[model samples]
Target: MLKFTTNLILLFISVTAFAQDSLSVETAAIDTVQVQQASKDSTVYKQRYGLRVGIDLSKPLRSFLEEDYQGLELLADFRISHNVYIAGALGNEEKTTQEDNYNFTTSGSYLKVGLDWNTYENWYGMENIINLGFRVGASTFSQTLNAYQIYNTNQYWNEIQSGIMGEDMLGEYSGLNALWAEIVLGMKVELFRNVFMGASVRLNYLVNNTQAGNFPNLFIPGFNKVTDGSKFGVGYNYSISYLIPIFKGNKPQKLPSNNQQEQED
Candidate 1:
């Protein structure tokens, strides 16, 4: 009887220890799952959305350095989505060009509206962008024929001196305008918090314009130099900008793997 009682007591003790071990294992599993869920929730990132305003630094620098050029440009953009922005520029320019046969001045104000699609994939907390963009540009401008020498194909004949032109030909041609479109490729780097520096190269295609009767449109204000019988031009800008944060949105977070979670725990 004593031997039987001792065996029964040993079996009961073994069962109780097994039950305790099983309960402990279940509790540990529940704790681990909760930890992983909390970690994922905490890892979500927040992105800033805002309006950014800037100035084209190259224009003012050119105005100061070049005697025949004066220009100013203001730029702005608003974030509409991740990797996309609505952007535009407003500017005024006056340029004097001395050609082989003529000297002319172009003065005008232009407006460009566009969208920038950022192609760069940034790391966490970085807002730098490499973008491809397009613009529709319009300008209202005037051209003045300062001086011109009449063209003579024959070298044997003495050429008329430059700056000797009729009064009608030396006057300003007003009420002139042009329309153009451009493809822009550029980058913006964040130099400081909410401050960015950017540069872009533009390939412009002239769509339409009104030309002076006697003088052709050799140079346009916003579109730059116009080639004879060609509808293409080129431009560039360097800018500095400031951002005003308006709101924030959540960015998707990458979750850790099981091994990483275990290591973290």
Candidate 2:
């Protein structure tokens, strides 16, 4: 009887130990699955980086509407970092203006290079931007003096018409150039998968100008109108662009708090 009772006690102890070990293994497997699911749910978001190319639509509309104006501008930008872009424009313009005493035409090509800083924060899967930028512009151009009337201080000689100058004063002046800088404020909105529409206002300051000996540079291609004594000018453009994505990058992630991390664990 003593031997039988001792064997029964040993069997009971072994059964209990085996049951506890099996329960521990099942608990560990459940914890591992929970951890994997949590990691999958906390994946980081990705962003696109690429080059965007476009044309200034306002230039084409103006060329169609204005009889004395013709212009074409092509613009491009590339993303170099988060919220920063390298941008540029290349264009050509020809314009004719009739002043009180003179008439002339100016034709030229211009190039502008710049950088843009974006200020907007986008939601997931959106790439809109509000940006402030700066540019340096250079132009090469020529001027043609079509007609002019000499200034006459004597009103009494108006009957004689000595102020009227004929074709003798008509001439073409070449090899003129100019340099300027501008501040740009703009916004861009994504219209479709890879299409965007944008607009910008610019404030320009003329840095240097090369003029003909006999005539002055009244207007520049990219710089617009030149006031008599002012170095400042204003301009704007509307554009539609398409993005050619180059690569993808993970967006910056924020760290969790201690309590949140403990809960996740």
Clash-forming residue pairs, model 2: none
| Full-model lDDT for every candidate | 0.91, 0.92
lDDT of 2: 0.92
- In angstroms, the error of model 2 at 206 is 0.2
Compared with the true structure, what per-residue lDDT tens digits does model 1 show for residues 177-208? 99999999999999999999999999999999
Q: Across residues 76-128, which tens digit of lDDT does each residue of candidate 2 receive?
A: 99999889999999999999999887799999999999999999987656899
Q: How many backbone clashes does candidate 1 have?
A: 0
Q: Give the lDDT of residue 178 in candidate 2.
A: 99
Residue 212, candidate 2: alpha-carbon lDDT? 82
